[model samples]
Target: MTSTAIAIAAGGGGDVVAASVLAQRLRHRFDVVAIMSYSWDRLIVDPTPGPRGLGDFDGLTSHHELVAQVTVSTVLRGPGRSTLPPLAHYVGCPLLLMDPVGGVAGLAAQFGAASRVFGAQTLLVVDVGGDILAEGTEAGLRSPLADSMSLAAAVRSGLGLHLLVAGLGLDGELTPPELTSLLQRHGATEVAELGAADVTRFAEVWNWHPSEASGLLCVAADGWRGRVETQRDALIDITDDATIVYEVDAYGVAANSLAANLIATTSLADAEQRVRTRRGYSDIDIERDRVPALARHDEWTPAADTVGAIDRYAYAAANRGVNALTIRRVLELAGASGAGAATRLRELLKCERPHNMRPPLYLA
Candidate 1:
């Protein structure tokens, strides 16, 4: 087999998109590049909370002897859903499904197995925003479990690890200056910057990916400079730094982050418990509580005056500080759901100069 390199997305689907962009760049360094990504998606996209495991999926192909490759046809076994299948089909590379159900040791074993099977010399753990480097004190930090787990697992995996932080502050979890300070503390070096060509490779996928942070990365790469309004009315600035990817000291980051304390976690529950105990909250808890409440009132029917409804939703969202929303969220706000919702949303947004909005992302 040809020489291979693996890039691990440090979060969920958004990180997977970021990994794909980085993996494409890695193709120049290795004959083959594969991405390992978590199945955790936002509530709007998956509905089912938490990351899905290997057994949760239906059409996964065995990768070599150990890993499972998510294909275009893969689907969740039941109520759970996945964006990995569509992502696999479009990313144009082997997209491996990484189940973090077993926590750090399990993840480490998976990492080692993939490295051995593919003869990979180095593992690149990529985070879209710099939250993986956060020390759990940033005011904006919301999701840190997955990123910290990946960092700890990769450190224990015993592979030559390279840490990359891309699209700084795009996730709205950490600001550019915050991440830059963390990077500087860890002695991270600036690597390559992603250009339009890199964004173009995945632009079509962006139309339906429902990954806000990744979409922001592409928009930033496309030279859009302004404040990007996201979920909860949080604002992310589109700056030149969003285009750069930094390679940091892997061991130093692991040693300093919440990952260090989580290194021995043998189960996901244990890891979540550790994070909650330290940070006073966990992201899974937030998802678990929020998803059901939203289900109660998230449904919306397209009003007879569709334009008026769109305008109302836009105005309401902005008043709440949200000027941009993911396609899934847009569908929810419009009270549209099921198979025809996306098409219906396309029609609804058209009257609002949706051309300015990217697919999967509506610039409200």
Candidate 2:
């Protein structure tokens, strides 16, 4: 079967949520084969330095294999547990993780191998935010290495990959005006907007992962295009374009920025070194060598203490909008699952906006 892999730019998780919306928007035209992502999810999972390359996994496999890859134990780390690949199995999307070990060339090779295995005709590296198009010098641009590296690998993959930037500026990395202007300069053409079904699917993911960015985009997609206030940061006037999924030729975006040069010219470490040299801080460098986000290490404590973990984690999930995957891990860490856990989760969780108090869609 002909496949089209949809890879979330940075580490997976919420990005997969965005890609799920994008895949539905594509209407199953392709197999949507492997849902590719990096292992470096710093938001919920502990931040590792570089991406947990393919080495961190048991190579490529089918959807069922994907589920087996990220067991509940794998997702739930105790107090000190840090990095874990996206609980992609929860969304029922098979995942492919690009290791940062080989730099651009290595990632390209990995992409090729996975594509060949899945018979992917086209590869699309998706970024939830439009930061994939950033030129690295943009003041607001923080994590350019992953996006730029994906862009570089797509170009080098020789597969003529497509680039999709959804919910532009919703990440607060770059404003909508800035992204639109960047695309215009890069000569990007308007591709397509998420359809009604697409919006419905997007809403499902948004409900579970009530992040500030995707929430704003979902609100916009549902026809609210005003400046939405969050606890922190400036009010962002999300435009109609927030729901629009824009694509550009990988080469064009690379040609427009010197950031692309770093990925193309140097190894992953070298490229990160250069960005750190210029930016004074590189998330890749710091996170690559960093510990697990949860800091629980691998072992799980007894079920007795799990109730406590559930209480604390539920509050964080409800109040902070930590996303569904993290909540699932919390449940797992607490030695909880199924209806009983769901009951505890509902009772413990606070805040009801977006109905995050309910069990996650994965659990439901």
Off by over 4 Å in 2: 1-11, 28-31, 47-50, 54-87, 90-93, 199-211, 230-232, 264-267, 285-364
TM-score of every prediction relative to native: 0.90, 0.69
Q: What tens-digit string does per-residue lDDT give for candidate 2 at 1-364?
A: 4356645444354666666666656645545755666665543333344555434544334333222234323443322121233345444566555566667777777777766776776777777778778876787776677777777777777884677777778777776678878878776766667545555544544333424555555555666544433323233555787787777767888776644666564367776776677778776655535354334432333354444555564555445433333234444455333323333543444332225432232111
| Backbone clashes under 3 angstroms, per model | 2, 20
Error of 2 at 254 (Å): 1.3
Question: What tens digits encode model 1's per-residue C-alpha lDDT throughout 143-245?
Answer: 9999999999999999878899898888888876888799899997877788888878677876666677888888788776665566565677678988988
Best by lDDT: 1
Q: What TM-score does prediction 1 earn?
A: 0.90
